[model samples]
Target chain A: MVSKSRSENVQIPIGPQHPALKEPESFLITLQGERITKSGVRLGYNHRGIEKACEQRTYIQAMYLIERVCGICSHSHSTAFVQAVEEVAGLQIPRRASYIRTLIGELERVHSHLLWLGVAGHEIGFDTLLMYTWRDREVVMDLLALLTGNRVNYGINTFGGVRRDVDAAQMEQVLKGVDILEERTKYYITVATDEVTLINRLSNVGKLAHDDAVRLGAVGPTARAAGVARDIRKDDPYAAYADLDFNVVTATQADVYGRTLVRVGELLESCKMIRQIIKNMPDGPVTVKAPRKVQAGEAFSRYEAPRGEDVHYVRGNGSDKPERVKVRAPTMANVQAVAHMLQDGYLADVPIVIAAIDPCFSCTDRLIGVARESGGRGIMTWEQARQAGIEWHRARGIDFTRLNETFRCGEPR
Target chain B: MQETQAVQAELMKTFPGLGEVRVPRARRIFWNVPYAEFARVFEAVTGPMKFTILCTMTGLDLGDNLGVIYHLARTSGVTLSLGTQVPKDAPVLQTISHVFPAADLYERELIDLLGIQVQGLGEGPRYPLPDGWPAGQYPLRKDWKVESLEGCKLGQMGVADGK
Candidate 1:
């Protein structure tokens, strides 16, 4: 009788931490029957304070700190950061370095797109596709390790140019692996486009119109799927992107399937770009000697990360360390669009809709640990932690007579 | 490249506030304007100028003033940055989310980390900073002493009393 008396609307919280998602993010979803009426995103669970950390470290140290901003897009972040520094320092790297940067960048895009395709499949309960794409992803991963000395955070990007040069043998290995990836991606494309089941499942699940996409400032595949026709590689032309010949792939459906098609199309484009880069590979030093101290100036640099436009702003105060370094990870620009994507979507399609954007869900993680104190420690709640805080403050002779009213501070129970 | 220069020259002539727009390189441009003039100048920049895609807004401390550098560009890739400043005591700027919805979260970031206020921003959570972040203790400010952050270090916790 009590259950029957309840209203149709029900609120469901997805995550600050959740089992369904690989990363930690909080989403409060309001549902009416099986349909979601409203969705809210809560950030800060993974805030790393890397921006503030950059202000304290030297330029060289900051570049390393930036690489860890997102494990998946390490080169994206480092390249953006270094490009801004290079701009401020007024350095033009070698042509060979530019070619190599673009090659590795496209390769990274290939691996990232493959990884996303598998994740999207898994989200839709198509584990077979997940198993297949991930297996093929290893080919690109192996090539990355061969060139950059690591798999995830490749660390290929240095100040003036790339730290590592692609040798003839390494270039051959890359080409051979790309050939395999290209064939596999073509097959996956047919599966994505021709399969009726996947189309039915993902089509129109999360719709963001062209106007909404641009208005929301959606980036990368999210905006491309909605037909925004914007890509930093074409617009800003950082590194070797200026010399590369590739169309900015886009789709007009403004839905999950459109996002898939755009990514699949981009996978082929990356493969094509990589082959051209290798064929036109120049011979020169990979790096120019960087400055010991950057002059006083600022630069705003942008890179088309696998996700979208990655922007980095750096300011030097005539010192070895930078005065400011601000990183706008593509996700930061795309996360707000997720809220719009979930509007009126089915409850079941939440994972796929969020996954469709490939939400990095992290970049900044500047949290204070929840030590035993109550004042400025971590965001700890519960009776035990509450009592410890009161007792600690009492021992410190900090009065608590009126603290209850003040401490509440509108923090929900 | 001439189109970039033309846009730069047009903008300088159109807005009385944009002082000596600096084109350090062919594609990149930076200009200084008073914070009071930001709202007026920003409308023209985002509207007729067509620098609609906001890359980001950078907030920094400038001794006695708090400064904001708004970076924006159209699909063409020529970035023109507008730097403006307000006195530290009254750090406020109008929200541009009406033009670029991406500014919603970035504006929240400025509020939380830089302690700058937005005049027209809608209500939202504290953003990238957690709810527990104490008010008036902006971490990005140069004067916000690092010693206060001693209790925030990892592995520095104690066993709760009466265990």
Candidate 2:
């Protein structure tokens, strides 16, 4: 995390051992002094071949498999796959199930955005923000477990309808959680807008213009931050999103700062959508019996995951097994943009720019272990490396505790 | 939907060999375009119909031939899927990375996993697969034999089949 001004410009590598290690993906950066001239990304160290595996499983079995695509957006992936299956089966899930789907989705978005805020804070030498946001993120995590019986993989979705229903008591608990999240999100919005150091560090860091965002096929907050105004929940409107009303948050900054604003704004939007779903939930059956074998057909399901646009292309045969299944996780679409964002930027800004995408890849912070021209080095754990980064910034007058203080509604910066 | 039909009309006029056009639902179009007409039809849909949002491509391992479907979308949210099958012996197609930059990743994937040669998608590092993975070995193909892959970690570990 230390920014060095080296006279000798050279190429540096960043990567990990395997899927066995905590961090896996690799990036090779050609640097001109401290600024990057070109960058390359090498992924698939932990390919898992989930798409190939899905084709071997039945529709019922594949639902469980798809849920594990991304741990953060497990519900998003499974829901997209199930919805595609439902569409191909021509089965209209009950209105209640759709509402529950939307409810869980927004809940996931809140927790995910909070998690990203913590990670982004850690990336930019603000460990206090990291500690505070993740502490608040546990509220929604517990609420999710209360609602779906699991924290990460909320197994609420099934082919015909949802597998679970919210009782009156659960509804009360979820609403209480939403109230807490909304209040905390407001504070984050204020901090992100009012904080001077954060603004200076992040603004104009990962600049992707609107046309570049579209041309590079950036999605989720990355595109919205660039003012693309594309949200699957609005444009396509799957599940109960068509019934719900919310704004697609956008910002013109088109950098890491804009992405932070977009995500925080979406956090409030998610909280609002959660309130709407619980207040106006319809009454209907929770589950409908779906056919064992889907008729021979194909469907492309799109979802606005916390990270970006998550899509699943499903082709089912008359047999129980699907003919083919392809998953384009949001990160896959946004990875190309990382190379674009890192171009001509300081090598030290790499972590934040990549983190700006809320990248769902499970790579650890040590994924960017920098070295001098000596060409070999020992390693530090992600936690240890981040601690060192905080200390390094602390040596340079970046006292975090002084920077973060209690917030009022209209407190001056 | 009207835009897709107009493109289909244009395709029919240009090359009179299109077959099996299916409109399963609104804002969704899936049809069988002949291999010879793929490039032009792709351009017409992406150019005229404005389905510039290349969601991704699906490389299907058809029994004797390879099937590639370009899943396209518009800002209006309409989805169009145009699929064509190429001979397994000569599985090659033109690159659309120039039309949409996002196609670079998916096209590289097709070349790596499915053994589909994408013309003009010039030399880059292998994607989603190990660099040491033997050439001419496509895992997604139906008849792919793992024994042909020399240094497979799982195979050497006796994971799937014991030596």
Candidate 3:
């Protein structure tokens, strides 16, 4: 009998649609004898042409468009964009409004990081850890829903100020939720770090060196995992970060476990920051009078989102419509490091490693892929294959024109 | 006068290729320079002042020209806005991706949508746009008339063939 070749082994497409990830992203993993040799992730199946949409909408309209960049971090986008515009217009956000913004942002972070922890637990085949974490995350969401009317994109923010104010009754609800979330987060942190199975699965897996972390320009927890002390909050503080006191967590291990620890530590820090905001928040006008037509100017703002630094830049031309709006979230920076993180790693570690970047498909779900290879030979490097495909398109008179529009900045719903 | 003079002096010394520093509004300042010296100016000022993070990169469709703006904010509480105007003849500027890795995606997106080119960024493929849009039909340009509902509606933009 002829022996079976490893090349003839099974290949699985994990998703442009899969239950494991909520976003429409597909990862093609070629397995050879029960070990993954290579993998490719495809995004943009859910590209909403956000950038294009923003170009058509006015500055006020674009604020809502940008907020939809990611559902989990919707406030972060809206706040970041608004802040950038406000900076350009030279408008000071009200003290109360700034505090409230910080509070809303931190609450979103609590839920998003917790949501990631749940998904991470699920990815590692720990259903119980997933369930417990998500259940706890619901409390944060419920609190957000109560505070902002909508659970997802709370339309509380406008250009220079907030749309609504938190009343005494609402403040009571926020206070209660903060108490419960603090307790749940404390317990979960213990379980995440102390659990034997979790430690074994995450530690030493998806190892990335500090040098690679900096060279690859990784951000958020991934870079922190590699012992790179770069936090947008610390490096470039925005919102209430400059006023608030919180430590940036770092780890020397540079593994999946280190990322988990950084996020967990951050969860606690966010809790502390939120509580401090509530106590120290000043009373004042929550909204400022913004110029209906923003004068021609350029500005940019950076926010520490759940994943990492979320940057929004806006250019106003003294019109209702902004000249241009650009967003650079942490996932864009961290995704570059994934190929390196996967190289030399075991096939089983692929999912966990990819998940470690906390890659957001909402931000990535755009663009069409060029299949450069025929018959699945798959010999060319990703870079080489991309270049070849571009050349092929050029030779064939294909116009790879991008959608020209404003990128509605925000989170995926 | 002293403050403005000192700022101008610092800017000139920092960016040798710097041409004109125009104070547009009360607080807003714009520095006009050639596309080649964008990174040099960014690196020169960002060192002592701690203006590390690149805030945003935006392109202007000036009818016949594409003006590129690099907004850099100092970590030491002062914000500095840098501007470079690239002529329509050659809408190419030096990529600040080396100085600020964050500019990689922003520059790529600009190239994708606005059709303006960045010289140094190691590009892969144009992201965000579909495979069939024609060359030079930059949707964001003032000239392109794309009536598709992709821009009009909020949630309904960029939906694939299916629902």
Candidate 4:
């Protein structure tokens, strides 16, 4: 690898609409040749003003509005919001309701991690892994639809408790589905660890030091991968996590490979927690009758979403409508560390590095881009760019003589 | 809940200017602090009390004044919410982004939506709003009105009624 000090400076803008990003967010990367020196992010392309919109709606209505914040982690959003509102109303839900909430939460985690695995595989040019992971992801989605009646925005959460209840038949189906997921996830762990191409693409890339991970406030699997050991489900123990038995997965690698392993490991843990929740589900009312108007007070609620810790602040004004609602998604906490991780890395590794955070721009769209030219000179032509690339490879002692002979014969045309 | 009381006592003994420490719920504690003591109290929580991660910073338009709530949390799960109010005319406060880099985006959101000026926050372009957005039109301030563009045609084709 070339030393960081000797690389040439160049600025490349990746996207408000790049293929790597599923949502609209841009990263303006400054590269010292192929090695990235600095990176700046710009968000807010899909800003719908959900926080402001929530303030205008009633507490019950805002629950539905907040559920649409992120399509994948919709259950987590509504649960956090409902928890805050329930606290303000001084309502304690039944034990059975909490168990059902935990079950859905864990199921959402399974689907989200599998979805991320597929995206990560596609990012590294492994189309087969992407196809297989997504095909398996459907099992959790089907189970979610069976439980909540919707796949993407599962509107299962109400104010005091959950809106739906699990039956014996659904619980049995969930157990069988989780069994298949557990076995498949164990196989995925082997593939992630032993596959040479996948390991080569992931390991040692986008390394976020353990201290930097904590200092920059990285959360969820991103922080867990760095051995931060901060999961709200385990730490705070809300919504039946206190009763469920599971271990918080951590890794010492603190790189893209570690993030991949951490997420896959969490998949297995979530499956186990799902089975535990179904087996020990308490028998009682699934929901309590919460008052329409909440007293004047504020509550802070946090939930461990699949990506990270998601927090919601709800303030009531003695009316049915909420005074102010603030949502801090995990992506907001993790994106800043992306700038830190991109430093001193190769530009070719940008996609996996950014995707490693599982950036949810739509949720965090509540942004800036500035282009400044310092020491970098003019842009290079296609031929000059190819020459620069060849020279870069030559400096690393790569022998491209045979490839150069074939390229030289067809270049004039 | 015990952790909330412990932190509250620590803050009260450390800083006398803390207005009211209210434990409205089980795990949540709200501290009302004067605007001048906002940064100092935030430092106390993150420093001595060890609330390492800033969960979020919320800016609210409370009719007569603007309020800023700093939601700070520890890895062990206690959340300390420090709230400070400023006059609506001059909603300025010290920036805590230097201490917690996570507060940078939250502060910028306040700047864009609530029209709150955060001193010591370094230079950055407008966030969450386009460059051509009209100035002084703070959307979240409750007073900002959404205008009606009655005759404005959205597409290239002429209006149906040719108004």
By TM-score, the best candidate is 1
**Every model: Cα RMSD to truth:** 9.5, 11.7, 10.6, 14.3
Model 3 Cα lDDT, one tens digit per residue, A10-46: 5677876676566666676766766666665544466
Candidate scoring better on TM-score of 1 and 4: 1
TM-score of 3: 0.79
- C-alpha TM-score for every candidate: 0.90, 0.86, 0.79, 0.87
Badly placed stretches (over 4 Å) of model 3 are A1-15, A18-20, A26-42, A364-413, B1-10, B20-32, B39-56, B70-82, B93-107, B118-123, B148-163
lDDT of each: 0.84, 0.82, 0.73, 0.84
Superior candidate under DockQ, 1 versus 4:
1
Model 2, range A289-364, lDDT digits (tens) per residue? Answer: 8999999889989999998888888888888989888888888888889999999999789888877888766311
Put down candidate 3 lDDT per residue, B11-109, tens digits, no spaces.
Answer: 877666567775533323567676576666666766764556455566667777887777665433234567777777778877777766657766876
Please list, in the order the candidates appear, how each scores on TM-score for chain B only: 0.87, 0.80, 0.71, 0.84
lDDT of candidate 4 at residue A110, scale 0 to 100: 94
How many angstroms is residue A79 displaced in model 1 relative to the true structure, after the best TM-score fit? 0.5
Candidate 1 backbone collisions, by pair? A15-A26, A46-A365, A47-A364, A47-A365, A47-A366, A48-A364, A48-A365, A48-A366, A49-A366, A370-A378
lDDT by residue (tens digit), candidate 1, B84-141: 9888998888888777778988888888888999988987666776564545767788
Instruction: Write out the backbone clash pairs for model 2.
Output: none
Interface RMSD of 1: 4.7
Candidate 1, residues A1-413: lDDT per residue as tens digits? 11243456888989877877878888999987777889998887888778888887888888898999988888888889998999999999999988887887888898899999999999999999999999999999999999899998888888898888888999999999999999999999999899999999889989999999888888999999999999989877878777789999999999999999999999999999999999989888999999979999999999999999889999999999999999888888888888888998898999999898888866633333454445534444345556676678889998555655677662324
Candidate 1 is scored at a TM of 0.90
